[model samples]
Target: MSSTAERQGGSPGGHPRGLYFLAGTELWERFSFYGMQALLTLYMVKQLLLPEFAENVWGLAALRGMAEGMFGTLGNVGFASVIAGLYSGLVYFTPLLGGLIADQLLGAKRTVTIGVLLMSAGHLAMTFDQLFVVALVLLILGSGLLKGNISSQVGTLYPQDDASMRDRGFAIFSTGINIGAAAGPLVTGAVAAIWGWHAGFAVAAGLMLVALATYLAGQKHLPDTPPRRHADFQHPPLSKADGKVVLALIAVILLTMPAEITYPMVWTIGPIWVDSYVNLGFVPATWFGSMDSIGAIASAPLLVMFWASQARKRREPDSLGKMAIGTGLVGVAALGLAAGSFIFPAKDSVPLIWAIACYFLMGVGWMYYWPTTLSLVSGVAPRAVVATMVSGAFISPFIAHLAAGVIGINFKRMSPSAFWAMDGAIGLAGAVLLFALRPMLNRALGTDKRKDAPENAF
Candidate 1:
């Protein structure tokens, strides 16, 4: 059924009012999500995950002894990295299945509600040490449902032909996300510093509860989700032509893996770096992670406007090209950090300016890619299989974060400069590959000098 606003037929704005509601919901949801993210790595290493507990729990002592015997000592940093990787990777990976469930069974509305509730429960569960793993599981599952579906719902607001509006809508929605991301860590980190980690988590739980209320109150204003008949989990087989476009899109998405692998550096290794090397007494390490979000929130409007202006002038780069630029920017950002690391002597703190510069550049780089990818995937997906295709794009991050976990393990093993430089090169390489494949990708995805291609066309 069409919303009353839609039925009224003379809506003042071309867009739906529900968009703002959804955007607000997303803002708070991200606030909760990133707030927890900022706390996760440090909490595991410095607070909850004790070595004695590890040794006593499920023969982990023997495993650690074996690991230490082979690869020196597995310190808290390494353990924290592994945990961060596992947590982050699961967050992305489960969205693949979550998107499917929404499409095939629950519909986007119910799925997102369930996701928020689960996350709220998980945040509350974080207060208990015994329920830690359970909390993680709930969070992972909740994020999977909420993350993809909410964005998917945003697209549903616009008609299929309104690509420009959809893209702009996503940018606006992304701005909300960045805003939340920026605020969440700052608030949570400050609270944690003042009170304690559990207190910080309690704040997150409160925020999520608030988010749920906000979403529920505004449900009428949001886009409607058509009821779906539950069916056995099965995707309709793609035609050969559809297969080519999907394969191409997947290939391009996979190209982002290298940059994605390094994303955790800001959160996983960042706190440790600040504590071990930077030695900034007044600023919390979680605040450094907030830099990326702050930068992104600041830059999103400018970038979105720039893209819109470029599109009007017919000078806008294709999505693949934009993503390539983003990939390179990440490398540049990493290089900036690497340079800072080179200048700062070992065991000494670098100037806060260096960290800020690195994070700001990273934020700029992410602006070039992340929202564009969301718009791209949402725009190109076949209507019958939209969620699945979005899920496929998420696979890039899934692989990246999993690799990040492995790379994070070695953060303490390698010099900071060397580690940043190596990953910088990886991002640069991915950029080079993507740029080289631009022409082919444009043809495959059918964005070159053309109107919208048929949904199944190569």
Candidate 2:
């Protein structure tokens, strides 16, 4: 009975009720995740990593001395970047192991459950100075389980044969992510500004609990995870064409690292830059994180329409071409920041609107590439290797964060323009490389064939 119910497709409304359930689950999960993230680096620098914190509290002089000795000559921004970079990077890497665990041992539902629980506990633990490391470990492990599985389950909610609807479903699902992204910083940042950083973290923890509750309430609606059998573990062999496509994708992912790095770098440290340079009287730095989400949400419907119109006219860019443009846009976003820095040219902060503008451009860039890449993989990879390609997609962030962390170390050494200019160059290089490879990608993946309906705009 359970299996039969799980096999049931979309509802009378032509979409699955499960999609809404999963979307709600993801919405709250992201709410908690980004909320905590918005505060993390600031919290670390203000409360944990700096000498001032230890100076104010008793029996902490040794800790302050240790940090000062270890991070010599690097300013607070650079030191904070190291910690943020490692934490952000490791979060992506854990998903690899989490995916394996979900496939082999616990199943998606159970793994996601465990992940949510750990994440909730991690957020709560952040209130304590002594348990900081433990908190990070729990959050990383939990995110690993929840992130991939929840997304995979969204695919399971649809019938196998309905390709068009499935793509639309993912598009709808992604909007939920953007909604959370926009709201998290606003709520958490405001809370921190009023009460304190610990309060902000506590709010994130509460949101995670809400997410857990939401998921559990919709448990009956969610598809069941099939038990893994040893004999069923083997992957089907990829054809020569698929093999070439896979290699092409690998190259693409490597080149997109600079673009990927922009996300974590901006969210973690962009606020620091804002705080140092921008003299906004009352605004919280974390509010800057919302710009990307706000831009994405505002432009989603518009972009969908634009793409659909282009597809109808046979003028829509291919996945690789879109990614090239997206990559270039991220560089353009960095350039925006550089422009603002030059305009200010003093120790004082520039108008907050300038930073907001940069974030909006980044949001536009993200909208083009991030969601599109998933569909590209689904469309291009052979059915037998789809799962492999999806898993491979996760590797981009893992590599991205590691390199971003290394990049973060240079924060203090370079001026704002120089730092951003460097990122801009990298993004442009990736774009040029992908543009050169577009012909090959077009042949391997074939042109977009879903012109039958505009609803397939994902």
Candidate 3:
């Protein structure tokens, strides 16, 4: 049988060609983003925020004063965590505005293009000490524009009725994300180790250019952006059912926050932890940042197959259940870190295997929740507000990062074991809440009727 994509004149028996193009574009974009991110916290703690170097940055004193005013006498590490948190948080938050612009004013493609240019400029700016704050502002704004619109475009590739294919497409797209994420830290970390931080930033800038080129190359294959909504245009009011679903989705986003808060810590404070505690013969700590993505990439196919087999037996998990499982696994991953910390103590370096295991588990947990949630939102959100809803889903991570940053400030004060255990407990709490709320969510989202065949039902 000709697959839906094939029937729609996409790649024969596969997905739309545009899917690969979008995935490719995103791969390089993530490569740039993650590459820079892998360096940011470490750079700040080790060099950039130090008194001598900090003085060279144009706005450092004022920014530090404002941060200290808000948070109260932050040490260098705490201050870096706060900045990292704010940067990560705002990147997710801005997508809401980006979605509005795409859905109402500029359309997805043009907005994405503008985003690429701004991000490219941002990456370039990262190479200069004077532009540190400015670079972050640009990257945050650019990412806001690119992230949601590109994701929404994936949904437009397949007919809305083909939920299964849409899910599969997202999985494939996520693979690109994992690959780039896995590679970014390794490459940039190695580059920084060999040369300097600015050299690493330059590489990220180059990668962003490649991303832009890939996006432009594939313009002909992408979906036509809908005409911009006019000032007088009015979407039909959302039905009462959609209103309920919206509320439920917002609840779901909130429920995911516990795990979200714990996950980014793997990167934000993770490198610092690894550098201080892990027994690395020669490997840079930033390389450890790749482990979660590596784990996710390795686990995706096996999980898909496992889910497929379970589906045949009518015992597959619903989206919420899978997300709960994912959340729990993330907790377990944090506990693994806690265990390592306890066993090794602060005086002794932790075994390399412990960090590897923890990061890998976190990745596996990510495979279960992140893409599943994206597919769920894309499949079920009301069409008129789909883009906004998709963007809003990111708000979970936004809140999580902000909270995580605050939590990260305590890393210096707390024992490593206590710190990780707290994170573990938070993740487990989220899982418990998600599991408890599953039935309620089902009814609210109108998926309760299809409970018997939930594998493909969502």
Clashes of each: 0, 3, 0
Q: How good is model 3 by TM-score? A: 0.93
Question: If the candidates were sorted by their TM-score against the true structure, best first, what order would they fall in?
Answer: 3, 2, 1
The estimated TM-scores of all candidates read: 0.87, 0.90, 0.93
Worst 10 residues of 2 by lDDT: 449-458
Clashing pairs in 2: 277-349, 278-349, 279-349
In candidate 3, the residue pairs with backbone N, CA or C atoms under 3 Å apart (3 or more residues apart, or in different chains) clash, namely: none
Model 1 alpha-carbon miss at residue 100, Å: 2.6
Q: Using TM-score, give the best candidate's number.
A: 3
Please state every model's RMSD to the true fold in angstroms: 4.3, 3.9, 3.1
Worst 10 residues of 3 by lDDT: 1-10
- Candidate 2 wrong stretches, greater than 4 Å: 1-12, 52-73, 233-235, 444-458
lDDT of 3 by residue, 321-428 (tens): 889999999999999998999999864389998799999999999989987897688667898777677777898999999999989988888998999999999999
Score residue 309 of candidate 1 by CA lDDT: 76
Residue 284 lDDT in model 3? 90
| Candidate 1 overall lDDT versus native | 0.79
Deviating ranges (above 4 Å) for candidate 1? 4-15, 52-73, 159-168, 223-227, 230-239, 279-281, 308-315, 381-384, 451-458
